[model samples]
Target: MEQLIQAIILGIIEGLTEFLPVSSTGHLILAGEWLGFVGESSKTFKIVIQLGAVLAVLVLYWSRFVSLAKDMLAWRFFRKGHLDALHIALALLPAVVLGFLLHGLIKQHLFGPEPVLYSLVAGGILMIIAERTKRRVTAEEMDDLSYRQALGIGCFQCLALWPGFSRSGSTISGGLLLGTSQKAAAEFTFIISVPIMLGASLLDLYESRDVLSSSDLPVFLVGLAASFIVAMLAVVTFINLIKRLRLTWFALYRFVLAAVFYFFVLM
Candidate 1:
């Protein structure tokens, strides 16, 4: 029962932080440390539960995904469209490659409180600087983004290989720095996340298959369901919030959270 409760809490944390500029993995690591949830099963749980958040994205953007599928079947996806599949692919390429290369090393060494603490602070500073130095918006909409801009964002996403740097934070801030509007960057962050996270979740599940068991099924299910529900709400709220506000707020939150974690959790 206690494990189940921990799962629910972790699920809520995952959903709340997944799409936000604040790092989801960073939060999970810190939360797990505090909750005494460290182990292979906990690690596997964190990765697998991300599927719930991915499902929320799918449900919210079902029509867009369906349109992309139809365009792919008709081979019109390359011509022109709002959700350019090619651009997303371009944006995902760098991270996919780097993630593949660094997967084992990251899991073995960097998936801990110390690395996350430093990364959270450093990423927050970068986000603040990026927002302050943002240029005139050239890509006002996700579809307006050129392949070059998408590639640049992908390159920025490489920074997120560090656990606390945050995939959305790096990509969206990179987009802003590269002249994409905030709303456009946030939408693209959500859209491109489906493939990247789905792929990563699958890889983690497969690699950690030994951690799966009938006894733990309920815990996994409860966590997955909780994350899905919360993520749906979070995604919608974040999109609306980004339309009216800057990402500096999230950066500030990250800075404060890092300090709290360092003093309370790490110390």
Candidate 2:
């Protein structure tokens, strides 16, 4: 019962932070550390439950995904003002290659609170700097993103390899630096996240299969369910928030959270 409750709590944390500029992995590591849930199996559980958040994206963007699929099948790469499959593929390639090369190193060294703390602070500063240095909004819509812009965003995503430097945060900041509108940047961040997270979750699950047990099935299910429900809400709310608010608010939150972690967890 206690374990199940812990799973639910972590699931909520995961859902709330996963899509936001605040790093979900960073939150999870801090939460797990404080809650006494840090372990190999727990790490695997975190990875597995993120699939629920991924599903939220699929549910919300089902139509877009369907359109993209159809466009690919028909080879109508540029029929209308929509992003082609090539754009997404190119955006994803950098992360795929870099992630493969650094996966082991990151898992071995950086999946802890100390590294996360540093990344949280650095990412927060980067976000603030990006937001303050505003540029003209060139890419006003997701469809307007060029292949070069996509590749650039993908390169920025490489920073997220360091936990606490959020994937969405890095990419959105990248898009902003490249003159993508706030809403467009947020949308693109969410769209590209589907493939990257799904692949990473599957890979983690496969590597950590040995740690999973039949007894942990219920915990996993509960976590997945909770995360899915909450993630749907978080994603929608975040999209709306980005439209009306500045990214600096999230950056401030990250800065404060990093300080709290340093005082409470590190010191």
Candidate 3:
């Protein structure tokens, strides 16, 4: 019963933070600490709930995703739609390569409260810097994104391999710095996130299979359902409101969250 409750709570946290500049992994770690849910299985649970959020993105962008998939399958490499597919792939490449290389090291060293808190603070500062120094918004929409810009954004996304340095935060900041507008950056961020996050979740599920049991299935299902439902709402709200929102505001929130966790939780 207690475990189920913790699962639901963590699921909500995952849903709320997954698409935002806030780090879902960081929040899950902190919440797990508070709820006494730390373990290999707990880590696995975090990754699994993230898939629920990824599912929300898929459902929300079903037509676009389907079109991208068709473009990929047909190898229509030079078509505009295929180019968009390539852009997402380029934006995912750097992180995917680096993450694959450093996966074990990152898991061993950075998946904890102390590292996460430091990353949260550092990521917040970076986001502010990106906003302040960003170039003029030349790319007003995702279709305006160039291959070079997409690759550059991917390089920035590598920062997210560090826990609490959020994937969305890194990518959106990268997009801003590369002259993309807020809405374009956010839409690109959301679209690009689906493949990588979904892949990572599946990989983690396979690797952590030894730790999970049939007994954990119900808890996992509950978390998955809660995360999916809440994530639908969160993503819709963000999309509707992002035009008027600023990354600096989210950055400030990250700063406060880090400080609070440091003083109250870590200390």
Candidate 4:
């Protein structure tokens, strides 16, 4: 009962931040460290429970997803239908490739807090630069985009494979840099995250098969539920916020959080 309770709490934390520009990985690492949930099962729990949040994306955006599929199947969408969905797939390709190629190395060494610490700092700096550039020019919103822009965004996504750097942060920042409106960049970032997260979680499940057992499976399920519920709210909130807010706010938070982790926790 005691262990189960701890697992449940950890699961909730994982779900809530997984999609937000705020680093879910960083929060999970810190949560485990502070709460004494850091154990053999920690990494697997973190990865697999992400399914919960991923489902939230699917559930909340089901209409857009369905429209996308219908349009693509008929091969008629675009001006007639919404094809931003296809662009999302195009954007996810780079992360999928890099994730697969570096599978073993990333899984073995990069999923922990210390690695994320550096990522938080470096990624924060990158966010500052992205924000500055975005501020210089009013981002333009195009109803449709060229494949080249999507591909460029996808390439930027590859930078997110490093544990601490966020897939949302990189892609959103990329969109801003390339002259996409905040809303468009954020929407694309959210859509692109679904596949990237799904692929990673499935891979982790395969790798962690040896450690699975019936006894603790329910904990993973609970965490999934918690994360999904929380992430739905988080995603909606994020979409609404970014339209009027600058990315610098997140950069400031990351810098402060990193410093706290360094002096208070690490020391």
Candidate 5:
């Protein structure tokens, strides 16, 4: 009974942080450390709950996602629609490969409080650097994106493999570096999430096959419910927040988390 309540609380935190560029894995690690959910199965539970948030993105962006597919098929405007989607796919390929290769290590060691602390600080520093550079807003819409640039951004995103670095954070920074508008980068980041989260969840479920079972199904369901609802809300709020707020705020958060982690873990 006690475990169930704790799991629900973790679910709420996972769902809200998963979508924003705030490093869901980092938060989960910190939460797990604080709540004594440091075991292997409990850690995986944090990741598996992301499946729920994945579905939320699927449902919320269904119309646009489908349109991207349909437009790609129609080969409109010389197949720019299809080509752009292909570019996104290309960008995701690196993480797909690296993620599977590092799956076990990431699950066991990367999500630990120590690593997460440093990752938070490093990621925060990178965000500040990216923010200070400049905002060019070169690509107004998806159609304006290029394959070469997409490939470049995709390569840049590979850096997020560290626990607290956040896939969205790396990708959005990639887009910003390549001169994408804030809204466009955010929109693309969210859209790109469908594939990335689906891939990660699938990999996690596969690796955790022996431990996962019907007995634990109820908890997974509850976590899913929490994650999906809060994720949708986070998505809505995050998009609005990105436009109005500066990246420095998130950077500050990372620095603060780093300091907190250092004090708690080292001292």
Candidate 6:
């Protein structure tokens, strides 16, 4: 019963923080520590629930994805109207390659409170700087992005491998600094998250297959379901809210969270 409650809490945390500039990984680490849920299985469970969040993106942007799929299937995805496929790939490439190379090292050394705390503080600073130094909005929509801009965002995404830095935060801030409008940057961020997070989740599940058991099924199911439902709501709300809410607010929130984490949790 206690474990199920913890699962639900963590699942909600994952959904809420996953797409936000705030880091879901950081929240989960602290939440798990508080709940006494630290273990190999706990880590696996956290990663697996991210799949539910990824599913939310697929559902929310089903038509867009279908269009991209149809274009790819027809071998026309590289044409003028279908550049999103290439853009997404460009935005994902650097992080994917770097993450693959550093995966084991990150899991071994950086998956801890101290690393997360430092990342949270550093990421917040980066977001603030991005906002202040943002250039004129050249890309009004994701489709307007140039390949170089997409790759630039991808390089920023490499920072997210440090756990609490946040993929959305890094990429969106990169977009802002690279001349993409706030809405466009956010749309690109959410869209690109799908493939990267889904792949990572699946990889984690595969590696942890030996430790998983039927007994853990209920907790996993509840967490996944909660994460999916909440993520759907969060994505929609965030999309609508991004226009009015500046990235600075989220950055400030990260600072507060980091301070609290250090004082209350780490102490």
| lDDT of candidate 5 at residue 237, scale 0 to 100 | 87
For residues 56-103, could you state the per-residue lDDT of candidate 2 as single tens digits? 999999999999999889987764467878778878899989998988
TM-score of 1: 0.96
lDDT of 6 by residue, 22-78 (tens): 899988887888889888889888878998899999999999888888877887646
What lDDT score goes with residue 235 in model 3?
93
Give Cα distance to truth, residue 129, candidate 4, Å: 0.4
Instruction: Give candidate 5's whole-model lDDT.
Output: 0.77
The models' CA-based lDDT, in order, is: 0.88, 0.88, 0.87, 0.75, 0.77, 0.87
Clashing pairs in 3: none
Candidate 6 lDDT: 0.87
TM-score between candidate 5 and the true structure: 0.91
The residue-by-residue lDDT of candidate 1 on 149-235, one tens digit each, is: 899999998888898999889988899899999888888888888988899888987887776778878988998999999999999
| TM-score of each predicted structure versus truth | 0.96, 0.96, 0.96, 0.90, 0.91, 0.96
lDDT of 3: 0.87
Q: Which residues of candidate 5, in runs, are more than 4 Å off?
A: 71-78, 81-83
lDDT of 3 at 7: 96
Candidate 4 scores a C-alpha RMSD against the true structure in Å of 2.3
Give the per-residue lDDT digits (tens) of candidate 5, residues 36-128: 776767766887888878888888888877877876788642454433567777777887888879878877677788888888877777777
